[model samples]
Target: MTKYCRYHRNHGHTTEECKALEEKIEELVRAGHFRRFVRKDDNSFRSHHPPRSDHRCPPCDSRHGKRLNQPANHDPQPARTNVTPVDPPLRGIINTISGGFAGGGSTSSVRKRHLRHIQSINHITHSHHRRRMPPITFTDDDFQGLDHQQDDPMVITVEIENYAVKKVLIDQGSSVDILYWATYQKLQLSDTAMVPYNEPIYGFSGEKVSTCGYIDLHIIFRDGAQTKTIPIRFLIVDAPTSYNVLLGCPSLNTLGAVVSTPHLAMKFSSPSGDILTIYGNQRLARECYMASLHPQLPILQTNHIERPPSSEIT
Candidate 1:
């Protein structure tokens, strides 16, 4: 009688000499599944082997394979175990084992790393939120004797880049400092000196204007015995304006300045704890206001002819 091959279910050869069964065993060993096929009677067979140095877990090497130690007949379905399944395309299964998908590390060190990251973000937010200047209180004496009936905007001359620039308006309603293109060119600054500015500015009339660029320059302000020099960033725009420059709220806030329109003066505390005051030039303010309105005013021409023209027409 011919010996039967148990693996291939053929009568041509015995199971030990079956080429198909040998190939199947080799495939199972390579896949790390050879232990599942071991017979119970084979007590001398060793199912698990120590992992080679290169095959050990990169994160923590407690086992040979990424799979947890399981019984030989354990179910293959994922729902049977609490272990999360790892994506096969990924390099290793340690990501699932360490719980890295929950926005943090799998081990104690990883958790510490995540905690540090969160703390850094919180610190930055707190720093920005807590930034505030000291109390800035104004008194009646801050605007002594300069109060007069006037409807002109506050205008002054300030030293910029060592040059006295006239027609500089102090506007508390403005959010950013502005330098008109004419004034910028008068400073003799080249195009290469300007940095790119992405923000746009809108006027009171709701007209939007794109900025040309921006430049940083030192501006010097004087108030009798006290003088303050600050670096001011001016957004350059090529629009027709009566004023050469505008000092807005940003500069005022940085200097802790307070403006009194009725007195045509501005006051701030100096670094040396002295009160610094700068009075506006009332005449320049009125002139700039008139110039701003000149383009909008209509022009009318009157012509008178002699009486002889009327008699000749009749």
Candidate 2:
């Protein structure tokens, strides 16, 4: 038979009772003092402290005061506020008239670029106005050979005044209108003509390309069989590798053009008697365009929701 101690193995009490120790322990707990207690089984002895009085330490979670179902009291902290200073409203008024433009940040190179654009524009405009040449006939009356396979495109057309140009392409996708300087010289827009463009013309890599400038007199397109003519600030650029002249937004706005690439067409009309219409194969245009339509619906302006804006309708 197995022999057991004075107290049973299951109970935490030791086999040998220490009566005076038990008497003092209960008194300390009642007085809110921390106390340690130990218990063991027949196999081995292990020590552990029993929990103290009912009152919990602060920050401690318990069922008595706060309910178990109550959510934690912490709320997220607010985000830090921006503290950057903003420009004074009067700065525009002051800068607009004053000769000092970009202020301390203006670099000599940048200033020269601005001056060059101004001077070149003046030179091109002056030479174009003073030294005239027999005008080139710009006809956009439905080219017979232009028809072919095409993807869907949104088409728009309008007239830009006396621009002496057949078509105006407003590919918001293109960084800028690329023009051929040779075309301007061919127009008899002669020398003292230094190509003064210094600003980087952006391209596919989103990098600037070096080039010269020229004047395209106008834009011509079709609005449902009616011819349209629009006036524009045309740039004559040297683009030997590409098309003769490019019509960037500056030219397109002058012509009031609406673009449609996916369907491979565009629509425009001029005040002039000749109607201009074009149809193209998107495969052909891939060399020139990166279509810009987005997957999300554009937030329609309140006025433009039902119909196109007044400027567009005209």
Candidate 3:
């Protein structure tokens, strides 16, 4: 007698004895299909998976009422509001803008008001730009192709107006985005493209650097087929620097890019919620650093003088 299998509709074996049928059922169970048939406490067909931990931001100071470092069993006490509120003086109509607080009263009240304002702003921002942004994580695998032994600045290439621009330095220290005059000229943009900005920017050495003006350009950051285009206002400065452009905190914050020096890469989320990573060229970064250190000096020319050797000596 032959056993009949309902799954295979064959007489070779029963469904319980069929290896292929068993495998198919197991695969479906693992894929979360037929969940109603699965036993909750059955260890025989159970799978254990650890919970994922996604890091949002760095650990903030716990003194600011954050429960980051609080013990699991510790109970938080309510904030004391015993301080006498001091009413801030009213200001008259001022012609010029001056320093002032939006919230008046005691320091605690002011801080609470400020926090509320920040929270409301964040809520509005998130409501407008809500998306499933993949968390940016820098793991040991991100360092696979990088040279871990050397300290190199993140110098990567970007596309501006469909032109591939190189030697773009990612500088978190800089508050503003900068575009070198040389690079701007190479881009073949007209002078009229820039809006006249008279404000001079200071360098890292506190030297006042004059700017020609500023221009808003759409820059493309790409990782293979995935790309993010952002309109960045770049200040065109006529300064001698190895880097063609300096990407600063303004653009970084706008892009929400996380720069990892150890990995020598910058990662950010695209509009489609894909994580796009831009890796730095270590060789180009080193070359740029070396070029900045030893700038091209003018060649000294010696004027040839003809003299009678013996008569001139006498």
Candidate 4:
């Protein structure tokens, strides 16, 4: 019922059926089209079209083999990838280091040091408010003034100070010492007395939990080899952690212990010895800080509000 056009006149068909008929003819032609240039070399066919709009192999572009341009489904990440890949050389070195990793027997620390030194130099020279803290060197005098502590059984030696090493946690972030009831009941600590913190305590998972009671415990520690004991306030936290005791900043500060990333341990000065350095790690801190910082966000904090009154005397 339709008329034929010049394009399909050779096909002996009307324009309505020309499209189907033309497709068959062009498909036969496209194979020859492919053989013509594809065998020209091994890489691929060089038959590309000019910049006009209708630039495509008529048969190849038709619905027979052509597909619609559908978008791919991308996944949204909840957090970091679950796969904790092995750390690179830098991370490995930091990992293997235990007790203390004061310096290298180790990584290409020289080159690494040089790079860091250059970076530090550049930063210091360019920055307006750059100040470096000098290293701590404790002589035999500043600590000699304190009262001497007596010997005890449960104490272990880290350095000069004697710390009581019970089945407890030595959290350096707490002001009041913590003691779990189970640990207390086990140790038979006095004053099963209750002093409750109405506020909730959060764990690494950030779940709120209740706290039970507070107890006073004697802590013993060692230096070089000598052991001693010190009385400390112990608060009971009702959490499921194996950490029966939590030692906070106040407790650490009272004992004259200093925590540094370099040593990766806690150093405590014993009453019997010189300034003793204990090592602790910062892996949690590193991971937490990294998790808190979005890749697109700037690390520096900016304040536009007015400054507070100066505390320094004139």
lDDT of each: 0.64, 0.39, 0.69, 0.40
In model 1, the runs with Cα more than 4 Å from the true position are: 1-147, 296-314
Q: In model 2, which regions exceed 4 Å deviation? A: 1-170, 192-195, 214-216, 222-225, 269-277, 281-314
Error of 4 at 112 (Å): 46
lDDT of 2 by residue, 176-196 (tens): 444456545533455444435
Q: Write the per-residue lDDT of candidate 1 for residues 1-314, one digit (tens) a residue.
A: 45565764544345555544554445555454555677657654433333224343223236765433232453223122233344568664321111111325225677688778778867567766655554555566655444366776888777776566777888876767888887887766798999887556666655577888888888878776567888787888887777889888767877778888777778777778777788788777776777777846531210111112213221
Compared with the true structure, what per-residue lDDT tens digits does model 4 show for residues 102-173? 121124565477557767866568656564333455444323212223111111122111222232334444
Order of candidates by TM-score, top first?
3, 1, 2, 4
TM-score of each: 0.50, 0.35, 0.54, 0.34
lDDT for predicted candidate 1 compared with the true structure: 0.64
Ranked by lDDT, the better of candidates 1 and 2 is: 1
Q: Considering summed lDDT, which 10 consecutive residues are worst modelled in model 4?
A: 96-105
- Could you report the Cα RMSD, in angstroms, for every candidate shown? 24.6, 22.3, 26.1, 24.2
| Per-residue lDDT of 144 in model 2 | 26
